[model samples]
Target: MSTYKAPLADIRFALYDVLGAEALFARLGFADASRDIVDAVLDEGARFNETVLAPLNRIGDEVGCVYDKTSGDVTTPPGFKQAYAQYVDGGWAGLTSPIEFGGQGMPHAAGVPLKEMIDAANLAWGNFPLLSHGATEALLHHGEAWQQEVFLKALVDGRWTGTMCLTEPHCGTDLGLLKTRATPNADGSHAVNGTKIFITAGEHDFTDNIVHLVLARLPDAPAGSKGISLFIVPKFKVGKDGVVGERNGVRCGAIEHKMGIHGSATCVINFDDAQGWLIGEPNKGLAAMFTMMNTARLAVGLQGLGLADRAYQNALRYARERLQGRSLSGPKQPDKPADPIIVHPDVRRMLLTQKALTEGGRLLGYHAATLVDVVGHGADEQERQQADALLGFVTPIVKACLTEWGVECTYHALQCFGGHGYIAEHGMEQLARDARITTLYEGTTGIQALDLMGRKVMQLQGAGLRVFLGMIEAFCKEQEGNEALHEFVAPLRAKAGEWQQLTISIGQRAVANADEVGAAAYDYLFYSGYVALAYWWARSVAAAETSSQSDAFKAAKRETARFYFARILPRTQAHAAAIGSGAASLMSMDVTHFGG
Candidate 1:
């Protein structure tokens, strides 16, 4: 089995070269995010993940999280709590949060790359802090001053962890169907009563408190989603100063048994009239919750990138080490009994696919984080609004595309391992199993696609698309006359134009038939994602051509760029055809005629 190693160099390339994070950070009002600080953080983060977190991955899967029925306490896998303690002591928890709340006050973009490393090391372990980051966002945005002072600091200080309590037994994607209730009390708090399911890190022994941002309905409110309100419901009651008091009415009814990420405690949380405070204004909870949901969607995208990077690294190592047969060219490894599998063309295809997706996905994911930084901390109102529009537009596409691509890349990586990957103990199968949940949780691929095509594209009138297209156009223009970038420039320019035209076409068709949105949604998302990656890959190749790096690194990048353009970018053609097919074929099928 190959041990996981943090891909620090690739991460640096994404941050410094392709993203130009230092220059971007300085321009975006983040003077503290110097290159020296970023690199030091990355180095130490990689070390902690490699030495402390990576080794606990299999341990997490094997032991899983233990549930104590007698006390309703969920204990994480062995060494998990200790590792978290180490994480907190190192001040890693507040890397990019606000300074007043105990954070380092760096640009969120710089923290995002480091987050990718943590997820790659141990996704289950990473889950504990991931939700906390999101909760911090939600609370910081919508919570009152006192709430922020009390809850946000605890979260940022790692004294507490957070969970987005959105789902219920009957409702996964439909928030309108949620039946959780919050009754007003005389003390300006509400009594929350409901059961939230599939809550990650919902009930864990890692911390003294679990802050739940729950969605429920009030008696006097309107019907459906509009009536729902957000609440701050803790596992334990707290005083005004955030001191832990008595246990609240919340309990972990059970921990779910799952196919992957066994270490993550997916719990059924029962809130029996738990004392809670309204997060934002009543009936505006969904709007407020999005502050965290958007944070999570982007974070989940990095999960895909992280999984792909780790799988590729191990697969590449195995491909070079495992000797199988002679190369088609013959005798390249005459000293060995047989040539390594890396000499085979098919093997190269798999490796190249993994490399292309992993690297391209990083550029996309990190860029989104930078947009988030701009949205949150940009110097002026106009800049923040523009960044917000672009960020909103790409969140769904990034969430859906990266995860769908992640599963595909992990499969290819495991396929490179042959039959050995399917069995346990080799650790290849573990990564595949772990990656399966990225698309399911947060939001499924279908939901993300619909959000992209419906909410982001149609409703917003392509506001986000216009910003994104402008970026592609700007980059394409810069490379137009450069001899070294001619191949990339023409194709990228064409794809951007084709994508804009496709969006307009889809919108027109959807006007006549609403089903056209659903029919074309998935295809449109993938189509958008592929073209987006093409832009980033082109930009990356341009960076490599001019960088002061070694010849071998530059050549590898150029070769990978060729592979992506020739093999991967062609995927957009099929998506475009499918999008053009309209909704007729899908609508033609009768519901009553379908077999059970």
Candidate 2:
């Protein structure tokens, strides 16, 4: 069986040493987020997830969720409820929420490490509360005062869980095709009639009332996505007095039999004239929903990072123990029948790839999380705006790359196990299965790539890219004199220059032919990601050199940085070449002849 232990040391190293998150929290007026307090939180979170949630991972996958056909109820896997209760009791649900709404008011970055621990410990189980973060963001940003009083407190305090109900049977990516309708009622509320599919935590026994942030079209609203409106539709209706009342006109029609994350209940939620209140202005629902979606996109990125770390952990453990062919040099362990598989060069390659990606991804995800704090509570308006731009730009990269890499790392880890990885006993296959969903959900890699290229870079005039490139230039200049970082600095500087030029080239081509954007988008996103990670890996080495980390730990950082630069950073070349190839090859084939 596989086991998981939170990489607390590395997590702290990333947060405090690499990102300097503690100082950022201090500057942002997060009084309760001092290093001491954050440390305590991390330690406790590690204990809770490692002990309570980690043990239930296999069981969660094995048993999955149970649905009652007659009652339209869903029961999560065993120990899930108990674990969630502990989680709520420990005040984890509101760790990063506003204090005014019964939360701890910690910086969003402070919560990321704990979130990573939860995901790594048990991903399916972690899905239960995952949507709540997005829901909380939607209500906080768009919901009215009354709505906040009635719904936000429950969600913040963990008395109830929340979900984002957007996708329907007819619509997954395109929200404009939605058929859900909402009609204003006599009591100042609306009657929401819709069927939303693939709603995570849509129906579960963890909470008595499930708050769903539903997207539906108001009557007389314009057509397409503009007609949409965000609504607060709870499973159990709540009154002004904050009392949970009778059941609303919502039920779980069914749950999906997914490829993985079986412990999570993905429900087909049907709302039959459910009493609902509008979250924001009518026909402005997509903007409000995006408030949730953006938050979710970041969280989903962490999910990928977490799963990859877990897979790497288990694979590393297995490789150290599993004896295989002798080392190429000779039998170092002559007493044994053969040396461990880890002695093989191929195995080391796979393990290092996982390490490089996960550790580098931690910085990428954590820095984005820090931007959440900065955008919300920056020292000045310009600071907040820049952070917002950079965050918007990085969100897609984090979501797509980390997730795609999650699938990659899991595959590598499973490969390390050889045939044993295929079997269920080693628990490697489950990780592989769970990692698959992160890429497909939230947004697929293709969608993210398009968003990064067409929307962020093209539409926004590369505001975020400008900010990121500036940082790279400054870092490169600062490190130019340091001989230790000379190798990484020059290459990173060159890549940064190339990245900027690549963006310009794509934009120039896109001006003439729109298809150029689509053709170059996927490759462009990945190229950006590889270069972005290269910067982080180099900074990681610089950070380690100055920190008080043990000599061995510091050496590991240098070696990993070396490996990443030499072996992994070269991936940018292929992506850049693909982008240079342009839209001709992609658009040349006739559509009708493609099926053959």
TM-score per candidate, in order? 0.99, 0.99
Candidate 1, residues 445-546: lDDT per residue as tens digits?
999999999998999888989999999999988887898888888988899999999999998998888999999999999999999999889988888878
Worst 10 residues of 2 by lDDT: 236-245
The CA lDDT at 464 in model 1 is 86
Candidate 2 lDDT over residue span 347-443, tens digit each? 9999999999999999999999999999999989999999999999999999999999999999999999999999999999999999999998888
The RMSD (Cα, Å) of candidate 2 is 0.8
Shift in Å, residue 293, candidate 1: 0.5
For candidate 2, what is the lDDT?
0.94
lDDT of each: 0.90, 0.94
What TM-score number comes out for model 2? 0.99
- Candidate with top TM-score is 2
